[model samples]
Target: MTSEPITVVLGSASPARLRVLRDAGLDPLVLVSDVDEEAIVDRLADAAPEHVVTALAQAKADAVVETIRGGDDPLFDAARTDGVVLTCDSMLLLDGRLSGKPHSPEVAIEQWHRMRGSTGHLITGHCVTRLHRGEADAATGHQSTSVRFSDVSDTLIERYVATGEPLKVAGAFTLDGLGGWLLDGIDGDPSSVIGISLPLTRRLLTDLDVDIADLWRA
Candidate 1:
């Protein structure tokens, strides 16, 4: 590992992901991707959710890596920096179907109704692009968490939908927000369900020869 502490640019705008990184001792700079998520979903209509999610994550990472390579950020100084550009995508797999941002309040309500008392998978794909002197070398890994939901009432689901949280998250819910009460348990890293996985991220950083401790700058 280099004596210099490494910095990271998160290739997403997810507040949850940002919090996860900060809580794990690495502070990341946010750079939202312009990748058309809906278009990617449509293009991979027949693909498995796992593959589709990873593809989207890689696409986002690639986009941001290209953006930085074209010009250095005064803060990041990509041209001389050794850093990581992280991107991730999460989706809930319920009964073999992929679920992401129910979009409409009605859809959120309907999905939550079915999700109650159910067990499903939350898959999050992670991509780490190593920026060495502005050149890119990428590594990727993904995690799947099994989540069990509480058997809540229809009124509760409707009320939660009205809160408008479900409408903006994958699987019409979240583990860190109001949706927490609705979750009975999780079988894997809760952070992955939130947006990113800390343990998995460390492995990816190691794969790219970046020391995870170097990011903490202690």
Candidate 2:
């Protein structure tokens, strides 16, 4: 027996996510989703951090599918009619508020001041969608991990933020880059804090009736 070919579409521009997929042995096609993240965040201001990220992940998946369907791309060629789309969103939960991409040096510094020597939840939402013959199937869920920040001096915080690495990353910190030294240790999936969780993504794909091993084979 032979299986049909499948193409996995990553609906995000985050290099962290791309690296995760590559490490998992899947070469996914990148398609940056054009969704208004701030609009959704504002609309769900009262919702839990997990729920908000989940909604954003779903929105990204929807946007990617809509874009591909509107075009006659070979990704949807008759032979590979059923293609998989994966999208994710992450946020930091600090003092009971959802935060994503500080967007400014001041905001990043402010966030770090409050985060120093504190524990926060790094929540990553995952969505996997399968498109076949005009029909779509999807599964969405979230993964949360506890991140503890190092109690660094104010001078160090300023130095780190000045590097401009924290301004565009969720939580204003990362475990795999310049921010690695700023973390004490994470209590859960380290990949979740970076951007996407491999375990979570595997489960989501299973929920959509897709085999995780197939992705690794690519």
Candidate 3:
């Protein structure tokens, strides 16, 4: 590891992912990628949820990496020297169907109706692009968590949907937000369910020969 700390370039606009990293002691520079998620998902219509999420995450990372390589933005100068671009995409797989952000109140309500009292697999793909010593390398992986929803009533679902939280998040629920009240339990990493998997991220950083500790805030 370099004596200098590695900067974290978060290639996502998700507040949840940024919070996850910040709470874990790493301060990340947020860079939102303009990748068309719906287009990518449509292109991989028949692929497994794991593969789809991974492809989406890689696409986002690649987009941001291109911007960093352009060298036009002084914001990325530190990142170009010794930084890791981390991107993630998450979806909920239920009954062989994949669902990303509902993006609509009606869709959120429908998703909750189908998910209430049922279990869904929350899969989050992670991609890490390391820019160190003028060379860039990447590693990708995913984490899957089984989340069980409570037998919430329609009235409650309607109330939750009114809050508009479900419309902006995958699975129409969250373990660390207002939706937490509607979830019974989770069988995997809770951090992944929130947005990013700390353990999986650590392993990916290891693959790129960067220690997670080296990326921690001073």
Provide the TM-score for each candidate, comma-separated: 0.95, 0.95, 0.98
* lDDT ranking, high to low: 3, 2, 1
Candidates ranked by TM-score:
3, 1, 2
Clash numbers, per candidate: 0, 0, 0
* Candidate 3 clashing pairs, residues 3+ apart or interchain: none
- Model 2 quality (TM-score): 0.95
Which candidate do you rate higher for TM-score, 2 or 3? 3
Model 2 regions more than 4 Å off? 75-80
Ten contiguous residues with the weakest lDDT in model 3: 1-10
Cα lDDT computed for each candidate against the true fold? 0.87, 0.88, 0.93
> lDDT tens digits, residues 1-218, model 2?
11766778889999998998898798888889999999999999888788999999999999998888887777546413678898999999989988899989899999999999999999999898988767889899999999999999999999999998998899899889999999999999988888989898888877877888766653
Candidate 3 Cα errors over 4 Å, as ranges: none
Pairs clashing within candidate 2: none
Task: For residues 1-218, write the lDDT of model 1, one tens digit per residue.
Answer: 57666778999988888998888887787788889998998999899888888999999998888777666578767423777899999899998888888989998988887889999999998899998865789998889999999999999999999998888888888999999999999999988999998889899989998878888836
RMSD of 2: 1.6
The reply for model 1, stretches above 4 Å from the true place, is 78-80
